[model samples]
Target: MKTIEIKCDGCGADITSTGNCFDYRLALVVETRAVQGPSVTAMAVSLPLDHDHHLCGINCLDQWRDRKRHEAKLWSDWNQQWKEEHATKDPSGRILAWQSPPREILDARRPEFEAAALAAFPMKVTK
Candidate 1:
Protein backbone atom coordinates (compact mmCIF):
# COMPACT_ATOMS: atom_id res chain seq x y z
CA MET A 1 0.00 0.00 0.00
CA LYS A 2 1.05 3.55 -0.68
CA THR A 3 1.39 5.86 2.30
CA ILE A 4 0.99 9.60 2.46
CA GLU A 5 1.75 12.08 5.21
CA ILE A 6 -0.78 14.58 6.53
CA LYS A 7 -1.05 16.92 9.46
CA CYS A 8 -3.86 18.38 11.48
CA ASP A 9 -5.06 21.30 9.41
CA GLY A 10 -6.00 23.40 12.43
CA CYS A 11 -3.08 22.95 14.83
CA GLY A 12 -0.46 21.71 12.39
CA ALA A 13 -0.03 18.59 14.45
CA ASP A 14 1.74 15.79 12.62
CA ILE A 15 -0.97 13.27 12.01
CA THR A 16 1.22 10.76 10.25
CA SER A 17 4.05 10.84 12.73
CA THR A 18 2.15 8.42 14.91
CA GLY A 19 0.17 6.62 12.20
CA ASN A 20 -1.65 7.07 8.92
CA CYS A 21 -4.93 8.21 10.35
CA PHE A 22 -6.97 11.37 10.62
CA ASP A 23 -9.96 12.58 12.54
CA TYR A 24 -11.92 14.17 9.77
CA ARG A 25 -12.07 14.83 6.03
CA LEU A 26 -13.87 17.34 3.87
CA ALA A 27 -14.45 17.67 0.13
CA LEU A 28 -15.78 20.60 -1.84
CA VAL A 29 -17.59 20.50 -5.14
CA VAL A 30 -15.73 22.59 -7.70
CA GLU A 31 -16.41 23.49 -11.27
CA THR A 32 -14.02 23.51 -14.18
CA ARG A 33 -14.08 24.51 -17.80
CA ALA A 34 -14.87 21.49 -19.93
CA VAL A 35 -12.19 20.49 -22.37
CA GLN A 36 -14.50 19.34 -25.15
CA GLY A 37 -17.63 21.35 -24.63
CA PRO A 38 -18.96 24.76 -23.72
CA SER A 39 -20.52 23.39 -20.54
CA VAL A 40 -18.72 23.43 -17.23
CA THR A 41 -18.03 20.36 -15.14
CA ALA A 42 -18.17 20.00 -11.39
CA MET A 43 -16.72 17.39 -9.08
CA ALA A 44 -16.04 16.80 -5.42
CA VAL A 45 -12.36 17.28 -4.68
CA SER A 46 -10.13 17.19 -1.60
CA LEU A 47 -7.80 20.13 -1.30
CA PRO A 48 -4.95 20.74 1.08
CA LEU A 49 -6.31 20.67 4.61
CA ASP A 50 -4.61 23.89 5.57
CA HIS A 51 -6.11 25.78 2.69
CA ASP A 52 -9.77 26.72 3.13
CA HIS A 53 -11.21 23.67 4.87
CA HIS A 54 -9.63 22.03 7.89
CA LEU A 55 -9.54 18.56 9.38
CA CYS A 56 -8.68 17.22 12.80
CA GLY A 57 -11.44 17.61 15.40
CA ILE A 58 -14.89 19.08 15.83
CA ASN A 59 -13.49 22.35 17.12
CA CYS A 60 -11.28 22.80 14.09
CA LEU A 61 -14.13 21.96 11.75
CA ASP A 62 -16.30 24.52 13.49
CA GLN A 63 -13.60 27.14 13.21
CA TRP A 64 -13.16 26.53 9.52
CA ARG A 65 -16.91 26.74 8.91
CA ASP A 66 -17.18 29.95 10.88
CA ARG A 67 -14.38 31.48 8.87
CA LYS A 68 -16.11 30.57 5.64
CA ARG A 69 -19.37 32.10 6.85
CA HIS A 70 -17.66 35.32 7.82
CA GLU A 71 -16.13 35.66 4.36
CA ALA A 72 -19.36 35.02 2.45
CA LYS A 73 -19.93 38.70 1.69
CA LEU A 74 -16.43 39.13 0.42
CA TRP A 75 -16.71 36.05 -1.69
CA SER A 76 -19.97 37.30 -3.15
CA ASP A 77 -18.39 40.58 -4.13
CA TRP A 78 -15.40 38.94 -5.69
CA ASN A 79 -17.51 36.41 -7.52
CA GLN A 80 -19.59 39.14 -9.15
CA GLN A 81 -16.45 40.93 -10.27
CA TRP A 82 -14.85 37.73 -11.51
CA LYS A 83 -17.90 36.70 -13.50
CA GLU A 84 -18.17 40.07 -15.11
CA GLU A 85 -14.58 39.89 -16.22
CA HIS A 86 -14.38 36.25 -17.29
CA ALA A 87 -17.82 35.26 -18.46
CA THR A 88 -18.55 35.03 -22.18
CA LYS A 89 -22.10 36.11 -22.85
CA ASP A 90 -24.24 35.48 -25.87
CA PRO A 91 -26.11 38.18 -27.72
CA SER A 92 -29.21 37.29 -25.70
CA GLY A 93 -27.21 37.96 -22.49
CA ARG A 94 -26.97 34.36 -21.35
CA ILE A 95 -23.53 33.25 -20.28
CA LEU A 96 -22.04 30.92 -22.89
CA ALA A 97 -18.76 30.12 -21.23
CA TRP A 98 -17.23 30.79 -17.87
CA GLN A 99 -14.13 29.72 -16.01
CA SER A 100 -14.69 28.97 -12.36
CA PRO A 101 -12.47 29.95 -9.50
CA PRO A 102 -10.49 27.50 -7.42
CA ARG A 103 -12.12 25.19 -4.90
CA GLU A 104 -11.01 27.20 -1.93
CA ILE A 105 -12.56 30.36 -3.25
CA LEU A 106 -15.80 28.58 -4.07
CA ASP A 107 -15.89 26.78 -0.73
CA ALA A 108 -15.47 30.04 1.11
CA ARG A 109 -18.78 31.23 -0.36
CA ARG A 110 -20.97 28.36 0.85
CA PRO A 111 -23.07 30.55 3.10
CA GLU A 112 -24.10 32.86 0.28
CA PHE A 113 -24.99 29.95 -1.97
CA GLU A 114 -26.99 28.26 0.78
CA ALA A 115 -28.90 31.44 1.47
CA ALA A 116 -29.72 31.89 -2.19
CA ALA A 117 -30.91 28.30 -2.40
CA LEU A 118 -33.16 28.72 0.61
CA ALA A 119 -34.65 31.86 -0.85
CA ALA A 120 -35.34 30.15 -4.15
CA PHE A 121 -37.10 27.22 -2.53
CA PRO A 122 -38.14 27.77 1.03
CA MET A 123 -38.33 24.49 2.86
CA LYS A 124 -41.60 23.69 4.64
CA VAL A 125 -41.37 22.64 8.25
CA THR A 126 -43.54 19.80 9.47
CA LYS A 127 -44.00 18.35 12.92
Candidate 2:
Protein backbone atom coordinates (compact mmCIF):
# COMPACT_ATOMS: atom_id res chain seq x y z
CA MET A 1 0.00 0.00 0.00
CA LYS A 2 1.07 3.62 -0.60
CA THR A 3 0.39 6.62 1.58
CA ILE A 4 -0.08 10.11 0.23
CA GLU A 5 0.07 13.24 2.37
CA ILE A 6 -1.53 16.51 1.51
CA LYS A 7 0.12 19.67 2.80
CA CYS A 8 -1.79 22.75 3.75
CA ASP A 9 -1.45 25.43 1.13
CA GLY A 10 -1.53 28.27 3.64
CA CYS A 11 1.10 27.13 6.12
CA GLY A 12 2.73 24.10 4.46
CA ALA A 13 1.78 21.90 7.38
CA ASP A 14 1.22 18.22 6.84
CA ILE A 15 -2.46 17.33 6.88
CA THR A 16 -3.09 14.17 8.82
CA SER A 17 -6.21 12.05 8.52
CA THR A 18 -7.73 13.62 11.64
CA GLY A 19 -6.40 17.16 11.13
CA ASN A 20 -8.59 20.08 10.13
CA CYS A 21 -8.28 21.71 6.71
CA PHE A 22 -10.32 23.76 4.27
CA ASP A 23 -10.48 24.07 0.50
CA TYR A 24 -12.14 26.67 -1.73
CA ARG A 25 -12.41 26.86 -5.48
CA LEU A 26 -13.87 29.45 -7.84
CA ALA A 27 -14.20 30.01 -11.57
CA LEU A 28 -13.83 33.44 -13.12
CA VAL A 29 -14.48 34.96 -16.52
CA VAL A 30 -11.98 37.37 -18.03
CA GLU A 31 -12.32 39.73 -20.96
CA THR A 32 -9.47 41.03 -23.05
CA ARG A 33 -9.27 43.40 -26.00
CA ALA A 34 -6.85 44.20 -28.78
CA VAL A 35 -6.39 47.38 -30.79
CA GLN A 36 -4.89 48.11 -34.18
CA GLY A 37 -3.71 51.39 -35.65
CA PRO A 38 -7.17 52.64 -36.49
CA SER A 39 -9.57 49.99 -35.28
CA VAL A 40 -10.40 48.20 -32.06
CA THR A 41 -11.17 44.52 -31.96
CA ALA A 42 -14.10 43.07 -30.14
CA MET A 43 -13.50 41.91 -26.64
CA ALA A 44 -12.47 38.29 -26.21
CA VAL A 45 -13.85 36.22 -23.37
CA SER A 46 -12.00 33.48 -21.53
CA LEU A 47 -13.00 31.29 -18.65
CA PRO A 48 -9.86 30.20 -16.86
CA LEU A 49 -9.61 27.26 -14.53
CA ASP A 50 -10.89 27.60 -11.01
CA HIS A 51 -8.61 29.05 -8.35
CA ASP A 52 -8.04 26.77 -5.41
CA HIS A 53 -7.14 27.69 -1.84
CA HIS A 54 -6.32 25.46 1.09
CA LEU A 55 -5.95 26.34 4.74
CA CYS A 56 -4.45 24.41 7.58
CA GLY A 57 -6.90 25.10 10.36
CA ILE A 58 -9.66 27.34 11.65
CA ASN A 59 -7.36 30.26 12.43
CA CYS A 60 -6.02 30.53 8.88
CA LEU A 61 -9.48 30.10 7.45
CA ASP A 62 -10.87 32.90 9.61
CA GLN A 63 -8.06 35.22 8.60
CA TRP A 64 -8.60 34.51 4.95
CA ARG A 65 -12.34 35.18 5.25
CA ASP A 66 -11.86 38.41 7.16
CA ARG A 67 -9.31 39.73 4.66
CA LYS A 68 -11.71 39.17 1.79
CA ARG A 69 -14.53 41.01 3.57
CA HIS A 70 -12.26 43.92 4.31
CA GLU A 71 -11.08 44.13 0.70
CA ALA A 72 -14.67 44.09 -0.59
CA LYS A 73 -15.63 46.95 1.70
CA LEU A 74 -12.65 48.98 0.58
CA TRP A 75 -13.54 48.46 -3.06
CA SER A 76 -17.13 49.54 -2.41
CA ASP A 77 -15.97 52.79 -0.84
CA TRP A 78 -13.53 53.57 -3.62
CA ASN A 79 -16.10 52.84 -6.32
CA GLN A 80 -18.61 55.17 -4.70
CA GLN A 81 -16.06 57.95 -4.48
CA TRP A 82 -15.02 57.49 -8.07
CA LYS A 83 -18.60 57.63 -9.32
CA GLU A 84 -19.33 60.76 -7.35
CA GLU A 85 -16.25 62.49 -8.68
CA HIS A 86 -16.57 61.48 -12.31
CA ALA A 87 -20.32 61.43 -12.87
CA THR A 88 -21.67 64.15 -15.10
CA LYS A 89 -24.79 65.80 -13.72
CA ASP A 90 -27.45 68.03 -15.27
CA PRO A 91 -28.98 71.14 -13.83
CA SER A 92 -31.49 69.04 -11.92
CA GLY A 93 -28.69 67.08 -10.26
CA ARG A 94 -29.44 63.98 -12.28
CA ILE A 95 -26.67 61.90 -13.75
CA LEU A 96 -26.52 62.75 -17.43
CA ALA A 97 -23.49 60.74 -18.39
CA TRP A 98 -21.10 58.15 -17.04
CA GLN A 99 -18.13 56.27 -18.34
CA SER A 100 -16.51 52.98 -17.57
CA PRO A 101 -13.44 53.25 -15.42
CA PRO A 102 -10.00 52.95 -16.93
CA ARG A 103 -8.36 49.56 -17.19
CA GLU A 104 -5.77 50.42 -14.57
CA ILE A 105 -8.45 51.31 -12.05
CA LEU A 106 -10.37 48.13 -12.75
CA ASP A 107 -7.22 46.11 -12.42
CA ALA A 108 -6.56 47.59 -9.03
CA ARG A 109 -10.01 46.54 -7.88
CA ARG A 110 -9.76 43.01 -9.22
CA PRO A 111 -8.78 41.54 -5.88
CA GLU A 112 -11.77 43.12 -4.17
CA PHE A 113 -14.15 41.78 -6.78
CA GLU A 114 -12.65 38.32 -6.46
CA ALA A 115 -12.90 38.49 -2.72
CA ALA A 116 -16.54 39.47 -2.82
CA ALA A 117 -17.37 36.64 -5.19
CA LEU A 118 -15.48 34.14 -3.09
CA ALA A 119 -17.30 35.21 0.01
CA ALA A 120 -20.68 35.18 -1.67
CA PHE A 121 -20.41 31.73 -3.25
CA PRO A 122 -17.82 30.03 -1.12
CA MET A 123 -17.33 26.34 -1.81
CA LYS A 124 -15.60 25.21 1.32
CA VAL A 125 -14.42 21.67 1.94
CA THR A 126 -13.49 20.54 5.42
CA LYS A 127 -11.57 17.45 6.43
Candidate 2: where are CA atoms >4 Å away? 1-50, 108-127
Relative to the true structure, how large is the alpha-carbon lDDT of every model? 0.56, 0.60
Candidate achieving the largest TM-score:
2
Instruction: Please write out the lDDT profile of model 2 over residues 1-127, one tens digit for every residue.
Output: 9987655433345554452656442212344445558865446844452354556667556655665666667778877778778999898877777786899989987976766656664534444
Checking candidate 1 for backbone clashes, the offending pairs are none
The Cα RMSD in angstroms, rounded to one decimal, for candidate 1 relative to the true structure is 12.8
Q: Worst ten-residue run, lDDT, model 2?
A: 23-32
Q: How do all models score by TM-score?
A: 0.33, 0.45
* Cα shift from native, residue 79, model 1 (Å): 2.3
